[model samples]
Target chain A: MSVRKTAFLALFTTFSLAVFAIEHAIPPLVPIPGIKLGLANVVTLILLRHFRARDAIFVLISRILLSSFLFGQALSLLYSLAGGLLSLCVMAAVMGLLQKKALFLTGAMGGLTHNLGQLAMALAITRTIGVLAYLPFLILSGILTGLFTGLCAGFAGKVLAPFLSDIS
Target chain B: MKKNTAWRKPAVIITAFLLLLSTASLLCLLARREKSDYAAEIFQDGVLIKSVYLNDISQTGTFIIQGENGCVNEIEIRPGSIAIISADCPDKLCVRQGFISDSKLPITCLPNRLVIRLRPVSDSSETTAVPDAVTY
Candidate 1:
């Protein structure tokens, strides 16, 4: 890869890591676990749009791995990886299958898939079907939060278009 | 695939559909919350460890719940609500959940593989709700 490409990836990864740390500091909106705004996903969405899925995955994994050391527990890494990889795949597929300017919808899809992935992991680890009770609530939160991040990505992309041209 | 194809049209329709579906299901699940005559059921790795009728408890106390590979959680039992007061798991999400008095949502400690939820007394427990018919 060229120097510019490598630099762009590094910059995006840093941006995502910063967002993850910031989001981590804020207490959960609800006392229940596994619910959050997922603000870092805005960086992933931006990268997915401006760059390739490969670049977005790089940043996503880096952010997850790095943030665990800073604020997350060791076991939480499994949940983050599961949710992150699944959401990335779904978001990329949505972006590919649909036309442009559907950022919000793509984000909502990503959010739904992210929660489903985590739920699956929880079920396997806990070995209880009762955890499935979180499905509807997770889906609702995922959609809402995903939409918010997607819109943030849209505006950020608009603002960065001039600067991103050279890197793209 | 290259054309814009009025993408907003389908996106809006699908968003609306998902919003409605999730909202309806959430309402359905939440309707079971805060019922009278509830029982607290604790489970570890899909196995029922203990259960107590909420109406019977006269005061608050704690139960030490154990999980696979030496995991532990201190669950506080109150008159009608259950809470995880402390835990040794990596993420203390269960402890932060405070208390739950109904079946609306279970307090689950994923790290420890423990779950605490409330059920109405009239409803049968997992042990007694066995299937009677068998064919081989």
Candidate 2:
């Protein structure tokens, strides 16, 4: 990659991390542990389309890991890892298969997958299927959050379209 | 041609998740009907602060009791009789969790450094729900 591309990637990655860190600083809108506005994923969806999936994956993992450390919650790292990996898989699959016009749908799926994966992991670690009781609430939030972030990403994609039009 | 098919993924996943959640809820309700004596310990900083039975609280009633430390924890015993009610915690996430009786969910108060947990009937070998392990 050229220096300009590398510089852009670094700056983008840092910007993404800043969004993640800042969102974490805000108290959760709901007292539920897993729900959040997921403001940072808007950046990820944008990166996924503009940059390579590998780079987007890198940014996602790096941000989650670093954010977990900063929060001083090592136990949380497991949930984050599970949620991030699942989200990346689904998002990349959908984004790769669908056209640019459908990017918002893919982003929505990513959000849903992220929440589902986290809830599944929480259930496993806690050794109780009772945690599954929260699945509906999480899924409902996932849909709403997904739509909001997807729209945000949709606009971000539009803004970056000119520069990224030729990447593929 | 394939336009609407894309929507199928989330639709399927969400439906499946909802079904599973309902199943879990039903199972919890069934389990609650069983007659079992449960001992829950509310521990604060390794000290046993409170102990209560699972069957002690009815479906609709306040489990609120002041501990010796003079802290009030509002426990709600409902269908899912989860014990951690209201706490002095800044987060108050535990308070909003509602009643959880399913033995799977534990009530946690971050501010008070307290955790209310349910142990299975067999594990309730101790005569008192509160263990002798911690200093009051």
Candidate 3:
């Protein structure tokens, strides 16, 4: 990759990490475990629009690792990593097949996938299947949150379209 | 991107999750409602050290259970509903997980091998906050 690409990826990853860290600091709007605005996802969605899928993957991996280190939660890194990868895969697959207008749908699906992945990891580590009880609540929250993040991504893409095209 | 009336994705996911929750609720309803035993066995080096039950818990704030390794495990029972409030472990996640009240689930700190399981009660009044299974 070119230096510019590397720099862009690094910048995007840092931006995502910042978003993730800040969101964690804020008290959860809902008492549910997986509910969150996931504002950081906007960067990934924007990248998917203007860049390649590989670029978005780079950003996602970097964000998960660096964010985990910053939080000093290395043990929990496995859960986050699995969840992030699954989410990115689902979002990218949906966005690639569906039209740009389905951004909200893609985001919601991504959020649900992410929570499922995390919950799976939790159950595996704890050696128990009891966590499946919260799936309904998590999915409901995911739909709401996914829609919000997707809208944010769409709005950002609209605002940047002209400049993005001009620069390219 | 073009948009269509493809609301099927979210609908399916939501339905699946709701079904799972209902199944859990059903299981909880079927299981006989009994009092919480609150009995916990503190084991170290594959040997049992002490077994403490809720009723016997004194008004004292904290008690230390000596493990075989001479590692004093400090257990703090907060008067009302006795739960393990803290432990010296890398991931304090289990500590923050609060209490367990069902036989199917146990709050475990992997690093410390400390397990806090809900012992089944023989009485008829106590209700478990969660079903005997783990909720996703």
Candidate 4:
């Protein structure tokens, strides 16, 4: 990768890590296990739009690993890894198939898959299928939060596009 | 780049479908209430450790469950509601989940491999109630 691209990714990684840490520090909005704003996803969506899937994946993995090391536990690390990877795959596919006009929908899809992935991990570890009842609640919250984050990314992309083109 | 409205149509349809599905599931969850004759079963490592009849219980009590790797969860049982009051798990998700009175949702401590589920009592003449589902 070019030095400029590497440096840009490093900057994005830092921004993502900061967002993750801040979100974690804030008290949960609800008592649900897998509900969160997922603000860092805005960065991922932006990266996927402006760059390549490979670059977005690198930044995402880095942010997950670094944030987990700094502020989360081993078990949470596993959950985040599973959720992040699944969400990334879904978002990448949506991006490729639908293009940028449907970025918000991609975000909603990512959120849904992310919750499913985490629920699957929870079911595996606890060995309980009854936990599947939480699926609907998770999906509801995922759609709302994902839409919010997706809109934020869309706005951020609009504001940064001109400056980014100048830099490149 | 050309501004296109084609993607909006599909996005709207998908979002509407998801909304409908979520609403239906929410209604089902809210409508399905277990009868008071249910029993709360505690499982550790997928093994039945304890079962308490919700109707029979007259007193509220808290008990500690020790699981693999020194994991501990303090479960609180009332006349009808059951909940995890405290736990050594990192996320404390089980604790944050509060209490449950129905069979629809099971409170689980994933890291500790502990599960608490409410199941309806069978009316058969058989004295022992066979588990409807095996967790593990």
Candidate 5:
């Protein structure tokens, strides 16, 4: 089981990294910064449901670090790390409360907090309240994108759950 | 899935409420009519590097912002507008943002932590008259 877990975690990390790189390669849908579907978050949602919290965090941190090194600048690393960790914490807490039933709810809340964390980081870095202007848009986009990722993860989890258990 | 319906009711309501609230605010922000006369302030690394009054510019030229991190963003400053004409950042989204002449939107270079906003020129000098004192 331990060996199998390692393999699964490795595969998840690889997939998340590939997704992150692919997201970067694709042109941003909105010309505005900080707007995206965050497709790799589906992997995080899947890990949260199927694996332990630590495994999810492991995949998240690895994806952020490697993606930043491969395709991002130094400052973006801080931004992504802040957003990723905060979103994961929110997802984990919501999962605990709801017993992991409403995956979309957890994802939505996670998406909101993710933008919030990055917003806070941006505020701290800029030391200006001007950036607060982005709040409403961020919240709106976060929920919609999060809901999308959450639903995808839920469907994927349902389809893959049997296969995972059987193979392991 | 037996009791799933119970919690999902409130969850859906909450999601809907939040979505509505954010959308309302976003629309309001967009619909705002702003004054064209303001200072185009450029800040890099959160420090004020340049502030040009859009309404009262004696010179129209471009300047290159060479950030400490070696990011170069060339800003094109015209009389009534300003824009990031080019940038060395990977995304170049700032350049794509085009020119902005009002306070409604700002041209932001995310990688370099650069922000260019059209804010009301500092209202400090009551004696210098309101509109035409700051232009060089």
Candidate 6:
């Protein structure tokens, strides 16, 4: 890979790690177990749009792995991996179909699928189906947070469009 | 730009639909209530370790369950609710979940491999309700 591309990936990875750390430091807005702003996702959405899916996935995996190592427990790593991969797949597919115009939609889809993926992991690890009860509440939170991050991503994409084109 | 606008219309419609569906589901979930006569079953590593009937309990009681790898959890049982008051797990998600009175969800400590679930006490007429069937 080119030095410039490598540098870009490193920079993006750092940005995402910072966002993840900051979000983690803040007390949860609601007492709900898996609810969060998912602010780092804005970076993921941006990377997915501005660069190739391969690059976006790399940044995502690196961010999750690094963040878990720094500020999370072993159990959290499992949940993050499941949620992160599911959301990434959903957002990429949605963006691929709808293009950049539907960035917010992609975000929302990612949010919902991310929660579902976590819940599935929770159910499996806990060995009880009762955890499914959190589905509705999780979905609602996912939609709201997803929409917020998606819009942020859309705005960021628009503002960075000219500069990003130069790098590519 | 023109193509973007066309996609935006469908996107908006889809978002609105999801919002409505989730809202309706949320309301339904909130409104659904579990029967008061039920039993709380505690499980460790997918094995049934203990069962307590909430209706028969009159006083609060607490017990500790130690799992593999030295993981410990303090489970509290009350008249009509059950919860994990404290745990040695790193996340303490089960403790934060607080008390649960219904069968809707269980308190789980993933690191400890501990699960506390409520199962409705079946009467003779309600025998048709499969105990193992996962509803919702």
Query: What are the chain A TM-scores for all the models, listed individually?
Result: 0.96, 0.91, 0.91, 0.95, 0.95, 0.97
Name the weakest run of 10 consecutive residues (lDDT summed) in model 5 chain A: A24-33
Query: Can you write out model 1's per-residue Cα lDDT over A32-54, one digit (the tens) per residue?
Result: 45778888889999889888899
Residue A82 error, candidate 1, Å: 1.0
Q: Would you list the C-alpha lDDT of every candidate in the order shown?
A: 0.80, 0.69, 0.67, 0.81, 0.80, 0.83
Share of the reference A-B contacts seen in candidate 6: 0.25
**Candidate 5, B1-136: lDDT as tens digits:** 4545556665666577667767787787777545436788888888998887788876778988888789988998988889999999999999998987765567899988999988866443322111211100
Off by over 4 Å in 6: B1-13, B33-136
The number of the candidate with the highest lDDT is 6
DockQ for candidate 1, C-alpha atoms: 0.15
Q: Per-residue alpha-carbon lDDT of model 2 for A1-168, expressed as tens digits?
A: 767776776777788778877877786565456888787888788888778788787777777777777773646778888887898888877776664445666767788888999888877876765666567667666766876888899988888789876643
How does model 6 score by TM-score?
Answer: 0.66
lDDT of 3 at A132: 65
Q: List the residue pairs that clash in candidate 2.
A: B80-B101, B81-B100, B81-B101, B82-B99, B82-B100, B82-B101
Give the Å shift of residue A144 in candidate 2: 2.1
For candidate 1, the per-residue lDDT at B107 reads 85
Q: What are the per-residue Cα lDDT tens digits for candidate 3 across A1-168?
A: 777668767888888888887887888665455667778888888888777788888888888777777773545588777677888898888776555555776777777788778878877876765566566666666666777888888888899887655432
Residue range with the least summed lDDT across 10 consecutive positions in model 3 chain B: B127-136
Residues A34-98, candidate 5: write the lDDT tens digits. 87888899999989888778889998998888887888765888899889999999898787766
Estimate the TM-score of every prediction.
0.69, 0.61, 0.59, 0.67, 0.67, 0.66
> What's the lDDT of the predicted structure labeled candidate 1?
0.80
TM-score of 5: 0.67
lDDT of 2 by residue, B27-93 (tens): 6666646555566677876688776666655656665656456666787655435555567646678
What does the TM-score come to for chain B in model 5? Answer: 0.62
**Clashing pairs for predicted structure model 4, backbone only:** none
lDDT of 4 by residue, A55-99 (tens): 989999999888878887657777888888899998888776665
Output the better candidate (3/6) by DockQ: 6
